[model samples]
Target chain A: MSAQIVAFGLLGGLVLYSAWRVATAPLITHAALFLALTLVGVAGFFFMLQAEFLAVVQILVYVGAVMTVIIFAIMLSTPALIRSGERPTLIQQILSPRYGAIPLLVGVAVTLLLLLAYGTVSWDQVPLTFHPSSQFPGGSTAQGTTGLIGEALLTRYIVPFEVVSLLLLAAMVGAIVLAVEGSRGKEDEARD
Target chain B: MTDVPVEAYLVVAVLLFGLGLFTALRRTNAIMILMGIELMLNAVNLNLVAFSRYLPAGLVDGQVFAVFVITLAAAEAAIGLGIVLMLARKRQSVDVSDFTELKG
Candidate 1:
């Protein structure tokens, strides 16, 4: 339990810090890297929560796929688009411009409200464990985390599964179309 | 595995969400705003998984929801990044503030 606590503290701190860096990093490339770190930290939390499938998926999708695309976008774009000509110092980046104060106030207010709600809830009084017999009909334990998730995905949630597949298909096609069109336009400009 | 309190997860979720909110609102880059949205979605997934584990039901509902969130986030990121690229190509920039020609 002590080890779990320590791991959680470390992972949680890393997540929070990197998330702040994702927001405040001056360069888009730096922000994307910090975003990847934040995703890895969240994957740690997923593992701590014993959701093995989620941890793997989080690492694969967020860290592998999504972060790669974001970094690619940062690279493909001109430096002027990725970062302002002025490379602000870290302190200046943290201070940001005057516009930052509004968002900061809003974010802090939302966080405090959530914390207040969390404090008022009596989560400790709630029973944490459920009978294994009630969950899995066979004599399997929670070690089969991935199996359980697969079963749930297919059996009870088939409709949403098909819908998500369709959504992914549409997104893939749309992305390709947009990318090709942009290149074509650039080619036309070059000809001009 | 129930040794950890649900509150701890909730606290982390709140912090992630807050950071995401700040990122989304403050950043002018469209891609950074998209990253912020991803952070917020991950926070929601954490909340769902924590409840799924701690609630007496112990069902995999939370994990299923989390999977969906991840899928949708991936889709959103692909489309959003494409849009950002096109915007950059069109205006020679990806800053959100510069794309406000539709402002009435």
Candidate 2:
């Protein structure tokens, strides 16, 4: 086995294990932390895929920003709810012979169906090497991906880029409004 | 140097998506469900990056699209967490099963 395959096996195992924990960990806080680990593993995959820019963004955005938001949400929640909400062990739930098995079954079914679909296509024609035309932006080097992506964002993808910025602005405003309203409601209840 | 096959990456992405689906369906906590959604998004991003690396003529489009997807995921997380916080405040619980006001 090549070192690349071994590395991939290790990273993939870490990702799958952490993802399973995120699904089954009894404590909400533990699950959130596990989710961060899963994201980090995915970032490792991005690095192995030669998308260095994306790897950095994955760590920065998902592991850093998104995980922080999730942890904060978990912290702000009622302690009683967080403590007592999800208490069943994964094995117990799977073996309970009730609706507990449904999620697992559904997940397995979806994965099998997707694999079946993937098998229908012949991917042998796809090249395993990363070779972009010399005319392509960034010239196909590992370091060029970031520059290429930046150029694309400004040139061919300008419209979508601008729209996403607008969407982010809207989402930010909406979140602040919702959060402020929630706290204001609490204050009103206090006054009453 | 032996390169990893794109199929290997696809398999990992598929497994990740399945696990995300399971988490979203199995968890009653709204934040956990959101986490599951994030996992699914990450899986999709993996697929995009893998294709970008191996596919001829793919150039940088896949990476650009992945960036957009990541941006969208961030926005979705912010909005989803905000809504969940509001629900928790009003209902005193984050359990999805408890919010049944619309069952009529």
Off by over 4 Å in 2: A81-86, A96-99, A126-143, B56-58
Measured against the true two-chain complex, the DockQ scores of the candidates, in the order shown, are 0.65, 0.71
Q: What would the per-residue lDDT of candidate 2 be over residues A1-192, giving only the tens digit for each residue?
A: 888889999999999999999888888888998999999999999877777789999999999999999988888875765566646666788876533588899999999999999999888764566553453334454555787788889999999999999999999999999999999999999999
Question: Global lDDT for candidate 1?
Answer: 0.84
B46-85: candidate 2 lDDT, tens digit per residue: 9998888765553678889999999999999999999998
Give TM-scores for every candidate, taking all chains together and pairing residue i with residue i. 0.90, 0.92
Task: Compose the digit string of candidate 1's lDDT tens values, residues A1-192.
Answer: 577788988999999999999888877788888999999999998887777789999999999999999888877765665556667675665465644877888999999999998788786676666433335322256455787778888999999999999999999999999999999999999999
Model number with the top TM-score: 2
Docking class of 1: medium
Which fraction of the native contacts appears in each prediction?
0.71, 0.82
